[model samples]
Target: MAEITTEDGVQIDLVSGERMKKLRSMEKIRLILDGVRDGNIVILEEGLSPDEESKLIEVTMTEISPDEFAGIEIESYPQQEPNPGFFSRLFGHNPPNKLTVIGPANRIETLHKDKNLIRALVT
Candidate 1:
């Protein structure tokens, strides 16, 4: 795992993932934002709720600059939502529970290219 220190000299581990499930939804969102802002790839094992996913994308998009880098890349492993209600079943629609990654395109690409690293951190 990579590490970085802030100006206040707080050392933070750069590699993180699903173990954060105990955090409240907005707290998790804050961590994601902080990681991305600091140019670190973030992984989420349990993934985000649909609303959180949308909000993440929206917030990240706004944070990007045309002059800085092209964009952020989001990747995910989609899982079926458990115990869909009758309406969801009847409508033949089940939104997925996604294992999401979000970060700068190049770094995110590097992380994706190394399956071993991904396995080590997320597993």
Candidate 2:
């Protein structure tokens, strides 16, 4: 379970497993709608399943919030870098850029190609 605070400062416990299941069930569409209406951003500790994550993207694309509930902003923060050795570079890759999605959770980092994708994701 993950603890998520709403914009109103109320904390809600979100069981990732349960929420995923709910999102897969008949409640999915409605739940997505509710999430948008409340101006809440969803965060998963380890991330979400592909299907569930896709649903979130779809829902976010459609829901239009009121001025008071405008969606949050997401920004990418690239890590300072010193290129690693050839072996290290070959064996492992650096982490994707960090993204802080400001809203209920204050910050979240996601690897993305560019700021446009970040903007699309946050909206």
Candidate 3:
């Protein structure tokens, strides 16, 4: 991985969609976790699937410690489909989420999230 420098003590890694598409599920989780552990915010261009998000939380629980590591904060909104086709409705296939933000819980606070915006405070 290339080095990403922080400005004003904040580092934001914006992972692009093409880069994300090439990684496997576990790889994606590791990438996100590593950034959070290093006190950097990670933004995924194409958000993870529901299963992936759940697995991430599960992994994070195992890694949390009192002094060394804090848990992470994750936020995302599912992409809205203006109209669902009959098959989509019957199959329960929802569109993928638009983006994901992951960071250390103690450092990043999510103030608000709606369909179009996410307001976060980073320390």
Query: Could you list the CA RMSD of all candidates, in the order they appear?
Result: 6.4, 9.2, 2.0
Residue 57 in candidate 1, Cα distance off native in Å: 0.8
Separate clash counts for every candidate: 0, 1, 0
Please report the candidate that would top lDDT against the real structure: 3
Q: On residues 3-114, what C-alpha lDDT tens digit does candidate 3 reach at each position?
A: 4676667888989878888999899999999889989899988888877888999999999998978899999988778999999999887676778989999999999998
* Clashes, model 3: 0
What TM-score, over all chains together, does every model reach? 0.58, 0.37, 0.88
By TM-score, rank the candidates, best first. 3, 1, 2
Per-residue lDDT tens digits for candidate 1, residues 70-108, read: 456666666656687899889876464455666666454
Clashing pairs in 3: none
Model 2 lDDT tens row, 86-114: 88679765543333232321222344646
Cα lDDT, model 1, residue 7: 65
Better of 1 and 2 by TM-score: 1
Clash list (residue pairs), candidate 1 = none
